[model samples]
Target: MPAHDLGPTDPAVTVPEITASVPTGPPPAWAVLQRRLFDELDGAWRTFRDRYTEPDGRLRFRGTIDDRDGADDFYEAFFNWPALYRLGGADDLLPAVKLHWEAVTRQLTELGLFHHEFERGYDWFHQGEALLMFYGICAADPADQRFRERAIRFAEQYLPQSPTGNYAPRIKAIRAPHNGSDGPRPGLGPQWDDRFGGEQSTMRPYGLPLHDVPGVAEWNDLADEELAVRMGHHMRDRLGRGDTAVNLAVTALVVNAWLYDHDPRLASWVREYVDAWRERSHAAGAMPDNVGLSGTVGEYHDGRWFGGHYGWTWPHGVHSVGAAALVGAISAGIVEGDADRLDLARRPLDQVWEQRRTGLPSDPEATRRPGWAHTLGPGDGPPVNTLPTRLGLDGWFDHQPAQVAYWTWLWWFGMRQEDRARLEALRDHSGYDWTVVHAFRDKEEAGHEPPWLAYLDGVNPDYPEQALRMALAQVAHRTALMAADEKGADGKRTHETGADDGLDLHKWQRLNPVVTEVLTQLTTGAPQTLYNGGLPLARVRYDDLDAARPGLPPDVAALVEHLDANGTTVELVNLGSSRTRRLRLLAGGFGEHLITTVHWNAAGGAYPGDSRDHHLPAGDEVARSAPVQDNTIHLTLPPGRRIRIRLDMRLNARQFAHHTSPTTSRRP
Candidate 1:
């Protein structure tokens, strides 16, 4: 069934007035930690803003991105600020986020990296990295006309009639592996030395996209200028042009526009583009990473399905492919309101899993062994769920334990039995406890889903407090790093450094203090969005009705305790000593869920004047219910009171949008 159909649609369904019990105890440990985390986050962001940004909110990077390497890094620094604001970070944080985005865009444009306010012909992986900030801004304040215009304009770049000419409708594919506002760039930039540094440090890791370059037997041969030029020419001829799997990420861009504008053309284009990839994945057996201009898989690699830009052979193989496939599948599902669209991603994942091995080979040099595993299982113990990470002409190699990054998303989007079973099976074979929290952070600043899922399963009861503390520790660590930088507290020499000096291209991400993965998962019941360009989806989002801002009101903290296909259970607590708080809860990030019934506990008898002082009678567990067929619930949380409510919801019931609130000034 279409997910939207699960919502209650009848107008005549009667709803009753409901109130929550006036609980008379100290707030839960998680609630206290949540409030404390928010307070620390506010200070941490202010410190980061002061040290890393100029007065105008521009990054302090003295070096310019004369090429495509640093734009994503620049934008990634502040990508989660808007998300922080949406989760009730300080109000000033939103304006700063906007300023940073504007400043970064202008900075990149001046450096010749961007045109039409978007990246100019870069891989979707980086493009997706750069756009996360833009997407968060829209989610935080969707009514901003500037964001609306940019969303629509950027989405248009991938359409059949795009002014940038990114799409070749004749072949039903994007024209090149690198694409953006400048459309499909003809080839890699001519300044090869500057592009990858004089020694080509970045390119050496991937070896070469194609092995049979006329005279190159080994990567070290490319150290010569002449051989390097030949390699460049071959990469330009074979790797630069063609639709790679990474291009599937464009579906998210188009889907964002449709969410804002409800344009039929935008929706149609997403379905068309995604469906084209869907057809190709099936025909090729395991989704081919590259398709030639003529629309044939492996047309450039002598009929091999794996070797393409950011495909199975080079860089991250199934990892990148799986991320892009998830985006395409989720976008298609959002457009159609059907979970079945997830098959676009599911099939490819299954195909990769079919090639799974028991463990790594005993011989050290037998394959391109990435590394020994430690996170999922003991490093020295027997390997568990060793799946291929990359594949080439020799065969599948680069093996490691399975990653739950995209599977977590698949389960969140579909909420189907099969996805649940698959996740459980993967967990059973993981050879590690699911509830253990790791301190390591990825580019997305996530990867704690196993523990989070355990919490939701009622096993890891302490995850909320543990994760919040983890977030606090991370912020403190990053803040200390920022203060200790050689550029000093103010980052005075940041702009003076050149990229050639090994100026830490990912410095921003490493030092960014804003951490939202724990808050997002616990409060919103959604996974950390795919950092490389996926929508910030949620089961519920909030607004501070009392403060007229886009987060929990002062002294208010929320926790979504349970989530499933049919309903959600959330606890709202007002920790203030006196002032009552009003909160507006929207079902789904874009008001896409229909909250059919709100069930809560209220005082059984009438309140004696002030409800906050009323001690509930013994065993007075009076439950109340209200039939709510819309997407919002206006909550009045009194001081010293906490309420836990189960919201019977139909996921993806309404047209997605940046909806305006009936009370707050938040606009549609």
Candidate 2:
């Protein structure tokens, strides 16, 4: 039986309420945050518009630089317009947005292309992606018939010619480029190969050709069924039946499923695709940087690397994997009603989070601690040069992480409240960007040229005092929300305090109390405990003992030293593996205190035997001191298992409080 089709008594079968828990009245804290966010957004828009928008209202295809003008325009327009709409409402930006839409439509019609062209250029894939954006824009704002017509036309052009056609021409052509390339070849059957002229390639679908064009009427036809069967057969045969292609194919399947809501066959395909990705991700202990329909992981053997090239990048890298996991999690929650899959989606995200927490740059920079290169020049460009590359740096101005976190917030809030709360707390405490930095460098300067550069500088200045202030603000906000909750006068629980009023006053009251207090404390300079400067801790895998232990050998004493130095926390689990190990901590003089109290599973309800209590007298080595303190902590663990631990400590007044917290409360 389908997950969503569970009987009435099933716990997972409850329907979610349609109403959102937006606060009423004037949530001063939310108002402040919103105002700040909007202010930055508005500034970003003006900067983008001034530099890219043409007099005719059509956004410029390229900035005054070397980047691909069309792609840049598409991303900026898409992110900016939809973000504005979602944050405020259509009313706030309807007019400007409409003008841009009109400009885009007119350009598409007059130029006879969905996107810009460079030489013999304008690849069909780019056009298809652009069409997808156009469709999305139309979906968000329905007033433009031309946008809809253009999207439909583009999609129709790629539909299989016959009901039982072997392959869609557009997809076939896309696979032809790598026919004999060193890269993985498409694994489609001989029929597909013969039809497209022998393109040896992996069978992963690279996100082109919209799948919802045919609608349900044609989707349920015998011809469509045959085509799906053939497609599956080709995928299994050529793609090695694995995870790489699973991500893209699954998304395609979901799009098709949405278009044919009642089709059991489509639903089955969706489940299969999701299952395959999940299985692969679990087996690898991480999702592939990218997987092909042929089941071959796309590995970069090419030596031409850039940007520290630390994690993954491009078609078969970290971003692709993260995007796949995100989409998969959301799809699984919506289609299969599987909360586990949604939780599992956090694996890849957690990988990035761990990297962030450790104050280790996800980019190759993590490899070289400091002084790797003296100057920041063009030749020293990043390996996986994507938009996030420029935005991931630590400082007052970088907004990449904030934007990424914000997008994550959208997905989490839309799907699950718990996840939303966790993400909200993470964003609030990260302190990646809280204050506005106002500095002007010549636009002609190397790093100062892009709007991203300006945005980063404006958000975070590179000064010590300013960074400290921003960091304090973040901590205050985080601490305040930790203790806040929403309740009604009648003692009824509610996400928001006020519901009937458009103002959302009650909701603000419930959420803002702690945040307000924290902010107030910070302004008065209260003490605070700063963890990795509010960044995520670096994650080291135990399998690579050397990497996990750094300077330690595979010995107990070495492990203790490593743990002590790194503020080591350990997770010991039993998976029927005979890998019991003793871990030790090195408390550097900071162990003179005891753990006063611990709230195990504070956010989530506690499990059996999960709580801990400590009452020790001062100067008692064993009782008063922890294994590690201030500088170092260590632990012993069994193999093939994991556990979470919270390490607490007291900091001086300087580290305790830096800035006033925001005037609102939140929970994570």
Candidate 1, residue 362: Cα displacement in angstroms equals 13
Where does model 1 exceed 4 Å of error? 1-18, 191-198, 214-217, 224-226, 358-382, 486-501, 605-619, 661-668
Tens-digit lDDT track of model 1 for 1-668: 25453332233433232334566356798899999999999999888788777887777766655565677888998878888899899878888899989988988888888887888888888888888899888888877889899999999888898778899998899999888888998665665421222276755655555677777777777777777777777777788888999998899898888887679999888888888888887887778899999999899999987888888877778778889999999898888877777887887677667787676433243233332233443345555566777887778777666777677888889899999887887788766678987665656777788999999999999999989888889889988887776464454444322532356767778888889999999889999989778988888988776676678888888999999999899988888878877777888887788888999887665443456657643435578787878777777777777788999987787767765433433222
In model 1, pairs of residues that clash are: 62-494, 62-495
Tens digit per residue, CA lDDT, model 2, 296-324: 33321112111111114312233334444
Quality of model 1 by C-alpha lDDT? 0.79
Cα deviation at 487, candidate 1, in Å, is 5.3
Predicted structure 2: clash tally: 63
| TM-score of every prediction relative to native | 0.91, 0.36
